[model samples]
Target: MSPNPPSSRALPPLVRIEGVTRRFGDTVALDGVDLDVRAGEFFALLGPSGCGKTTLLRVLAGFETPDSGTVSLDGRDLRGVPAHRRPVNLMFQSYALFPHMSVEKNVAYGLARERLPRAEIRERVAAVLATVGLTAQARRRPHQLSGGQRQRVALARAIVKRPRLLLLDEPLSALDKNVRAEMQLELKRLQLEAGITFLVVTHDQEEAMSLADRIAVLDRGRILQVDTPVELYRHPQGRFVAGFVGSNNIFSGHLLPSGGLDVPGVGVLPAPVGVGSAAGLVAVAVRPESIQVAAADAKGGEGLLHGTVLDVSFHGGSSRIAVTVPALESPVLVTASGPATVTAGTPVALSWDPSSAVLVETEETTWKTGGQAT
Candidate 1:
């Protein structure tokens, strides 16, 4: 089956992976994977190290083949196609520019190999260079440019081929934080202007969230979820997805008599409506910013749980406070704006609307409400 259900639109996906599995020795790198990337879309394969994201990208680029399954691009099966013969370009993280060659020559390398006319190659090279905002640096060698400029050169080289797809492996991993952020925007803009489908492999959740139209979260050779960044962050389908895509304060609880969650020692927290009064919910995840914190002694309020502040970290506009609550196995993290008026060892109260808590399903025994065994 496709990773996602067929869309209502009639346009076919530009790239497709069906039941693809790759294994090395006794280890499985990809397990029965299926995916569809739409044309002109900026898609991301996001996961942590050893998650087989890069392996899948390599498979699409023709550097590696799945042990069992098929990959196709623009309606053609790529089973027997060699890497060079495939109409896809893979850009490495290192930028891989030739130090001895000028920027324009580097960008024209692929076209030269195809034995294109010199005038056509020059025209394409110049046009792509200008598209990437690297026209001024055309005559400069790789060593003469900044890291971001070198990356653009590499991007220009890949796009000059006018390939059906462009595969990037950790494209910004080599840049500093500031430069990385700038390039993220630049890369997105470049993709739009070129109108090329980009499949980027990354371990950085924030990068994937910022650059991709849709992201596929992979873990241990399996896809956990595929959704827009906001959807994945706010409405994750399962526990793994809730924890992986963003930072969340997860509470383990059972269904309560009032249709809320009876979190062990913590007070009953309301669950989002429509979760059903089922006892199958084993956990609920709430973003730190969703919970409100105040001084415990100031007022007694409904839905409020008291705790002692364990630590507070300030990050310009927001502060991350960890509070030790008796009902929780670990400190509950809260992100608040304004001053850090609450310090370590201070008593605080945390409260949040039930609507903010997301039910996360897990493989746990179900317990009925009122502490009754079903």
Candidate 2:
């Protein structure tokens, strides 16, 4: 028998923010931001500091109210819904577990507020604690557990209440790298098992990329782009999206009439697509891996630009080379699969496929002083 296909229904969004704006005195923290969290999907809000990521999270948790918008949960307008009354739970950056309360008490606190039968509360708390792998340490207090353990306890407590929507505010920021990786997996598993909508706010791009089904890249109170991690990486809409999501080497040149761009020393690069400009300033964005470096004067290759190796850094499994092309004002970055074959002050040539480079429109009138194109 064929396996049953997943059901399709116009399931209402678990969380929705419409025309949300938050201001602290004269400083606008969020500006007409709109977002949606589909049921049972892991969605992430990603941005740098002062970009309004956290402020948006606060609005969804009912910790803060929008000056001129509505926050809704499952199609119900949530205006004036106090934090405690809303069917949403927030996992804070600090984890915020009570120091005096044991793991069991911490998880049972919310259930007790609801006054469930004692047996049912105990059973539910036990199940949640086990789900987070903290059942063995039920009697332990916050001080006795490690950072990861404390975080899991916080997760257990938030989940025990079984809220329809779960909000996580940088939930794994404090753990060590290895522990954070493990928790990322665990959190995904728990979210799958629980089948509730999860909306996370984080500045760590890697975390957001790994954990989210889709990401909304925010900046200065505005969402610049929203798409899957792969889509954002492979086909960024603009220079900002390309540079922000990952490392990119950018070069500035003018589009030529022959469907190619002329770099002073790099020669004409045929445009991958019809650019339709003869002398307009343009920026070319390419990832380090896209640029291939070889010994200077390597014969029989198209799109070659010769340069001197200004610096090289070995970063385990791959090496980064900073090459300075004479015509370009700054050095271009290229990543080799293994250790560098050419040392500093040595000559090298860089070549890349026409398809690998993305032409961008420059926003800044003058390039920055350093070699950094971003």
Candidate 3:
């Protein structure tokens, strides 16, 4: 068989944000946030509510202006560009479809406003409808269609303008679980087909993890960290990133001389980084999968902590167990490959490789009462 073609890498950024800051009265919405969205790449701004993700999207779409700093697209400053004149389109969370217009008319609305030729407008609308798989429902109104179908119509409308950039503000938040998954795949395919830079804003970590080429995790109007999904998960910069990205078992304690954090129950467990005497408080983060349960005598295992199985949950492919170690205030979650062999109230030895645990800077918002750091 012929060798498969190499997958395409990201091109240079087409949109750039430099020291962007936006404020509403005394409240800062975006605080010196700097970001770049590469050509044809799907980038996501991820954070919880009031984190400035939506504000950044609005800035990019020309719906809002920054109080300080600059917004540029293709190296051109967008300070004076009005929303209607910018070569960008935004798909809102509400789908924002005109209830009075049919699917075909909604998709063609932008082109019609530009006063395009009659035949050309119809051709472009038909093309975008086909791309979003909405051609069959072209005559249906927004109320007549399902949530996912309405979303596709919105996407078709956004792309019909042939803009260089696309902005999506929680476009999939309204759909059900199954439809959300389907739309995620469809959106990825559409971005690849259109070759336009896509910037999405979402608080849903799973959506950002699944769809983004690179994610910018924001907090309180500041960009905390930006990296690929796997890098963000495997090596979080701090306690917030670790806890926000996925489930983690965190321990808070002082670093001991033996290159481990001295938790009450876990003792001196090996850590990924060395903490000198200068660092007073430290937190250790380890994914549930990194934890292992053995029969009290696993060879070559150091820093073994003995705990009793407090609870067990079967989650189809894997089993999750909450084990409570003596001297620890909270239970540590452990994941096993198959069904849970250990029952609640059973004694078990909980151990993990020293390399699996990541040492992070302690934050006040870390998990309370947990032996591990959040």
Candidate 4:
């Protein structure tokens, strides 16, 4: 088996979820879920909507009781603890700032509810406001501040309690594209400075990849894969993860005995040499950026798949080229960093190193030794 990318941090898990199950009537929102979040490392539970990420988050928050299994924080069991009693804070996507109150007041409300001293509350609020870069706008109401600033207010309010774990539910969904991108960086920085374990639930792959040190991909009601961002993109273990995490050109074929994938019409695609007797049907996933494409003069043959360039889209730093191969059902997507030389409707040749292609199986099958999976 190939080695996976090392996690950035290897501290002990601050939050441990074991055999957790939640159901609403006949619908099972979470099914025997297990996960561990390292101390002070930013983590994300990522999946599509209704994938049970929210239910897991609610379970941790004590809002939804699990049907079975146990949840522990800092080695302490949280079976019957109430939401407010737990050492965790949840920041909603809505920001949910009090419209009538100023930014400082909104943040200070949580502390005031706990009946903290006046001097201590003033000092902590000032410090957290400064940390989130909202000191100048402390007195300004949420209605008076920008979207990003209001988000900071909500975050500051959550972290003000110095909670051991901070849960963020679709934290950036409210912001526009540009502002959301900016806040991603801000959120990462805040997590580091606050020195708290931040576990965010987001359906956005980009957000999870960019913000979290490690991410758990949830599907249906089960955890599909938990890995670092780079590892998840570079080495997806199964067909579902390959299709879900990023754009992949997947080719379904049978594993050849001679260490190659046998597509019915495409001949044998190269797999790693010395692959043992593992055979049968499998899917090969090649990332768009991994494949190389160039214009073909006459009909480039020999270890190359000839195709017609269908589309070339320039996206700032790179251009995405789509080529339709005669034997393939889907276009072979390729990414080029330089200028877009090949125009649409031009003849092209698609080729990539054997190492660039990954042999992927369904979620239920064992990993086969071939292609990149080797």
What is the C-alpha lDDT profile of model 2 across 150-265, one tens digit per residue?
98999989999999999999999999999999999888889888877788999888888888888899988888888878877766766777778888877666666545566554
What is the C-alpha lDDT profile of model 1 across 152-251, one tens digit per residue?
9999999999988999999999999999999999999898899888999999998998998889999999988888787888888877788887788777
lDDT of 4 at 78: 98
Worst 10 residues of 3 by lDDT: 1-10
Off by over 4 Å in 1: 1-10, 277-281, 298-303, 365-374
Off by over 4 Å in 3: 1-10, 256-258, 264-266, 273-278, 295-303, 362-374
RMSD of each: 4.4, 3.9, 3.9, 3.9
How many steric overlaps does candidate 4 have? Answer: 0
* Pairwise lDDT winner, candidates 2 and 4: 4
Evaluate model 3: give its TM-score: 0.90
Q: TM-score per candidate, in order? A: 0.92, 0.89, 0.90, 0.93
lDDT per residue as tens, model 3, 1-374: 01111232435568889999999999999999998877777888999999999999999999899999999998999998999989999999998899999999999988998999999999999999999998899999999999999999999999999999999999999999999999998998898898877889999898888888888999999999988888888888877888888888888776776676776544676674554353556778889999988644322343377777889999999999998776677788898998998888877888787788887566545344347523
What is the lDDT of every predicted structure here?
A: 0.84, 0.81, 0.84, 0.84
Higher-TM-score candidate of 2 and 4: 4
User: How do these models rank on TM-score, best leading?
Assistant: 4, 1, 3, 2
Report the C-alpha lDDT of model 4 over 174-226, residue by residue, as the tens digit.
Answer: 89999999999999889989998899999998889899888899998999899
